[model samples]
Target: MRPDPEGLLPATEPVTLIDSDGAPVTPARAAVPPASELVAALGAMITARRFNDQAYALVRQGRLAVYPSSHGQEACQVAAARVLSDGDWLFPTYRDTAAVVARGVDPGQTLTLLSGEWHHGWDVATHRVAPLTTPLATQLPHAVGVAHAARLRGEDTVVLALCGDGGTSEGDFHEALNFAAVLRAPVVFLVQNNTFAISVPLSRQTAAPSLAHKGAGYGIPGQRVDGNDVAALLAVLGAAVDAARTGGGPQLVEAHTYRMQAHTNADDATRYRDDDEVAVWSRRDPVERLRTFLTRRGDVDEARLAAFADDAERLAARLRDELAADLRHDPSELFEHVYATPTPQLREQLAMLRDEATRDTPAGGSR
Candidate 1:
């Protein structure tokens, strides 16, 4: 007896559009959004790259406590934000500052958590973007809850939750995926398989065929896409978001990309990885690939490209100026949101801090 040709088979490769040389290997499909829309997406990726560079600079200058640069993964960041509607929500990890900015959160405000500020920089309620989470996989549950609530309230809202390869190992990641699948929540879980969870490489992360396969256990459709290809990312992520919005239930997208920088300013990627590996990924740079494709199609000219560069530079300068400004925050703010009603121990600590501040000030002079 022979097996049926229609039998289920494993995915052989990730969805790809343009190759590293900027040549289209696949025919353009109608599912591809308009040229203008793709151009805008490219612009967002360029701007995000500039922002990531500026953040790295800020960390080096002691302005920011630390920064997880999303240099090589800007395509994932841009596509994740572009696919969401204004009424939707985005739950980002620490390295997803670019996605939050792409969602229209102010650059300075978005950097507040990295700047060692008291609270999350922007207004979550107004922007519909969650605070950049430092704890691994914690935002997954939050995203699922919001999506489930939206379904209950009969609201037309979708939630995009982002995480890295390491985050998938967290228990919260499994819990969120299972709950979302069981409840048929309107959420898209994007796992950027950047090849490392800090010093640990993906080889040791999991033995599964691919990270996308993990979603299958929870009964959610999973897809693998070339994270370095902007066109492919936009196409895959857009479809996932649309499906969730129209009651298709939750979906998982595992984008295969690389982290070109250290985990954060505090880490030393050089110790764990080789220059040869970094050099290999450098050739597949997302920004250059998109720019080349657009230019080849005559959709973008030198003058227009220069204007985009100018815009990115202006954004970086604005962020630098805002972050460089002298702004004093009250120390008392640390205790403000700790609890609706302050605990006795917290009150005592606040009093001690206030007393210390008073003693440090010159007599009869304002601090």
Candidate 2:
């Protein structure tokens, strides 16, 4: 594909459709998206934006201890999530809750996960979306393992692993890619380069030109795309997922995006990045870009956009209420899943703890 240098996308190079203003830019000419698809994409983008906003608010209010914001990277996530097949597995990081929601997990259930009420949120096995791994870059090897298992079982399932650019530095990243390549497992490693690992900039992450180039070392196909461009993100991920489903081994995709918000509720980005940098990224807001594109093309009118916003608000309110009513896990429940059968030492410890609790209680009181 030829690069469109005129379109100033967030990436170092541009190879996607629909610029930040929603102009339909082609290799030869610029145009617009189809009416129906454009409206749907617009609605999805709006809903996703609202979802991220509400999630951030909840984090600030202490409803959630910490949250990795997906404020600016929703396009890449939503597009990728939409491309998954039924049997495919998604290994997502902490910041990928949006993609998880798009892949069929309910936002309420996500709240449960983030709140630490559940260990395996949304039944990963049933949902085909694995539990969100907080540890950096660990899920890549797990995705490779899932792909290998599917192959052994004669199942045509692909594993799509999502991670941030900072995760690329881990030893597991290299190990997982090498193993997948050697075994020819069906997997797609989607790297969302938001240019920061918490407060650390991409300059400290790597000297490589792009994360895609890292795939060459593992002998896999490598590609880069404008992560903020919804249509282009969809097209690229669609092709990659199709290839994986059809027996293609693996591919590495570096999605160039920006983290418009802090890394998480606990982070303060201002200490590391200047206000000017944030302002630059704000101009490329994926949600606003798509909305502008849809409006300019007459694909979705203002009333329709308003309706989407209304629906998103209603959904967010419902999620807030539902999460409020869900039971918070008992602290003791933490030990429940630690073993299939308790070891002798663990059993003795539990017994001792139980006796101590009983002894400490008042004569007629139950503890």
Q: lDDT tens digits, residues 1-367, model 2?
A: 3223332122356456877776777572223334675577667777778888898888766677677889999897787677688888889898998888778788878766676565745887789998889899999999999999999898999889999999999999999999998988999899999999998888999998778878877777778888898777777777778787788788778898999898887788889999998888888888888888778877778789889999889868976876666365444565566799777787777777778877899999866
Candidate 1's residue-wise lDDT over 1-367, tens digit each?
A: 3323222122568887877888786665425556797789888999999999999999888889999999999999999999999999999999999999999999999999788877888999999999888899999999999999999999979999999999999999999999998988999999999999999999899998888888878878888888998888889899989999999889899999999999998998889999999999999999999899889998888998888889899999999988996558777888878999889999999999999999999999997
lDDT of each: 0.90, 0.80
- The C-alpha stretches of model 1 lying farther than 4 A from their native spots are 1-10, 27-30, 343-345
After TM-score superposition, what is the CA distance of residue 10 in candidate 2 from its true location, in Å?
Answer: 16
Q: Tell me the spans in candidate 2 whose CA falls farther than 4 Å from its real position.
A: 1-12, 28-35, 118-120, 325-327, 356-367
Report the number of the highest-TM-score candidate.
1
Total clashing pairs for each candidate:
0, 1
The top-ranked prediction according to lDDT is: 1
Candidate 1 global lDDT: 0.90
